[model samples]
Target: MPDTALPPTIPTAPVTPAILESLRAIVGDKGLIADDQGKQPFVTDWRGSIVGNAAVVVRPANVEEVSKVVKLCHDNGIAIVPQAGNTGLMGGATPWPSHTGIVLSVGRMNKVLNVDPVGYSMTVEAGCVLQTLQETAASHDRFFPLFLGAQGSCMIGGNLSTNAGGVQVLRYGNARNLVMGLEVVLPNGDIWNGLRALKKDNTGYDLKHLFMGAEGTLGIITKAVLKLWPAAKDVATAWLAIRDPQAAIEILSEAHGASEDNVGSCELMSRTCTDMVLRNIPGTQDPLKADTEWFLLLEWTSARPKAEGAEGMAEKMEQFLADQMEAGRVIDAVIAQSEAQARNMWVIRESVAPASRAEGPGLSYDISVSISKVPEFIERGLKAALDILPSIRPYPLGHIGDGNIHFSFMGPKGMDRETLKQYSPAITRAVNDLVTSLDGSISAEHGIGIDKLDELSHYRSRIELDTMRTIKRALDPKNIMNPGKVLRI
Candidate 1:
């Protein structure tokens, strides 16, 4: 396990024999994982970097069971680490190494409660897999626009907790925006059921927002009412070899009108990032074999069906690409002729994280700036890192339209993981400093988990940090809900 800084003071009280019996009585043996081997995966972060420990791994069958288990822990002052699909890159779902409390796994509460096709909304349990919800929405002739690499296993609760930003965020907004209401289990085990599917609710404090992106620090998200959109009947997916980051943004800027405001996603990919994925992830093919430094995976979707011989999404995209090529922004572009072709393009984009893991030790920063500053950030960011480690291989990609970049790098070739760690501190400092100077966020979509604990404290101002701590204390005075996460308090 990689060395990580833990909270200065967290509840380290062990689950004694009596408390264990009480827990078993509440959840039954089927829900409790008492053995260390059974609890290992729950405590370990997805990247396998931070390994924590829990006295027991508890899987509640439903909200009542969850409330009972939490109340038991709360009454005794035992720490509770609420976890969902456990697919977060940040260590938010993982318990701290010193934790002796319970790892509350909500995977068993997977359920789609209601689907309102006319209302364009769905009520679901937090433990429902994101892909499952998307499929459910599709079956109802609707669309859930949270598309990410880990949708297959990541849960809705964790997604909301992280306020996840996926490929389609440019069009649909983040997880919190999609959420109309939430049912959270508070730190003290009190249930807050704000599961109304209303588009307009100005009832005082809008309490649901607090739990959405709190990273399970304020409370545990138990259920949610998610907004949906009409299923796309006409779609266009294309791969364009763009001139550069500037050109990529300009193309997207013009595309908003050219596609008639139907642009669903605009993802920027560096040549190095694409090459890494092609090398590491098998069965992936390059979409456009053009000689260019950058690429854009652009998709446009419309709810209206394509009429015969009419100007549909494909026709419109074709014209846009032609205009872009003439304008010197697009060098070469190909609109997918079939579903299989589009799937292949998306596979290459989504497989980047896994491909990097397969490659070896590396550093990744999920930072963001204004849309226009993306090119400048990339240019200067690359220079800053290369100055520190000239051999470090750069693999940069992002949801360019949204200004969120996953600035990443592979360690110097042939360097061991231990040796790579030595350069991490200097490189991290340089990159973060540059981001701060540019008025950009040091951490973007990925919340400040155990990995960025100190970084958050370092970057955030005294007032901002104090405001966050005040809220944290107000919600979770005992500091038992996912302790040592998001904030030092």
Candidate 2:
């Protein structure tokens, strides 16, 4: 094949107010927005990695409204960018460069559609905030276990769209595993009512899975039936300082394997991570209050006799701590004795991001490998980044207990924007390459929104990328759904 000249350039799409008026009439003033000020929030991604201005933003109150809006957009040859809380990390909820497009905001559709304690599940509108769903489940004495940092504001719809994975993923699995059914509004404005809370449905095709992590390119998730668990009678949380990274992995393996998978959660934190949290985050005082190299946040939930006999469980936890201490693997430990205290411990762990940001700007990567191989990967990643770009401060910390870590590097303080941009981005890619070489995912939790689109080509196979594009084309033939996101179209 010889080099050939390409065809003439295509023209940009035109915008008209007549089309805007038609959209506004469908959604009403309260539901429709056209001004740049009103649209700016929905234009850029959470990280400000990608920015796009839409022709309008629409908020539909229900499935009927969403279907109508999507159908209208599709018919008018308008691109639709679906969004929820706009708290998504992967830029999954952010719109991209507009060839005359609109954003579909699901915020107005928030509602607890259904709660079935007997069924151990809750069917909720996609726009429902995670914290609101948690409260709804608490009212029934049941639990929805998709615990994460953004639970307070992140909408379930966005969570489902990205198939988000958080700390509790070790037990409840990712959002895809938690979702039993979905109610999606397709590109053609038809509704997919897979909202049944059935545990087992051997139907021909599990249509819901297609949109689970499609990031709204396939369709907009309007509602979802999520799997819930019985509320545990008691929970024990502990913060410990560990000897080494490898030993920390062994501890998690031993505890999770022996506890009948009862270990609720485990997280690893480095000294730099905690120091920044305590220094920056308001009301974030240290849990240890003393100098510690590394920390582990461990949690265990039990249903066994707490009122009758829980001495054995408490003793087992104490014995586990004692054994670690004796082996010099664990230097310090503090176990929560009450629910309030347990929540406080979590508050500290969740406050890491904001506190770290207050310290300085940094380039972060959320990547994962097998637990057994995480140490090697981290070591190599740190070495690789430093080799290419020394004088960079590494602030690596995350769910090492689960093989997922937000390995990041903070640029030299007080450096100008140009210098950091020139070096840090190169460093981020260097770390991502290291993640790929170990057969690990470049994106462990966050999807390949605009932020990670570059790495998708580097990590994903040609066949894999092609299959994804085929599915996207099949679901959204016009390529109007979330245009220029995930993959360049």
Most lDDT-accurate candidate: 1
Q: Candidate 2: which pairs clash?
A: none
What's each prediction's clash count? 0, 0
Q: What is the Cα-based TM-score of model 2?
A: 0.94
Cα error, candidate 1, residue 478 (Å): 1.1
Model 1 Cα RMSD, 1 decimal: 1.0
Off by over 4 Å in 2: 1-15, 97-99, 257-260
> The CA-based lDDT of model 2 is what?
0.79
| Tens-digit lDDT track of model 1 for 1-489 | 333354557888889999999999998999999898999899998889888889999999999989988888888999999999999987999987788899999999899999999999999998999999999999999999999899999999999999999999899998889999999899888898899999999879999888878899998899999999999999999999999999999999999999999999999999989998999888999999999989999999999999998999999999999999999999999999999999999999999999999999999999999999999999999999999999999989999989999999999899988998888888888999999999999888988878888888889999999999999999888888899888887
Q: Give per-residue CA lDDT, model 2, range 1-489, as digits (tens).
A: 001111111113434678777777778889987788989888876655557667788998889989988887788778788999888776667654543677899999998877888888888888899989988888888888887787898899999999888888888788999988999998899998888888889978999999988888889999998998888776778888887677788788878754556788888888877777777776655677646678888887776646765454455667888888887878888887777777777887887766655666667788999889888987899898888777777777777766888887777767754677777556767787788778888888888776777668667889989998898888888777876667655
If scored against the real structure, what TM-score would every candidate get? Answer: 0.99, 0.94
Instruction: Give, for candidate 1, the lowest lDDT window spanning 10 residues.
Output: 1-10
TM accuracy, model 1: 0.99
Model 1, residue 45: distance off in Å is: 1.0
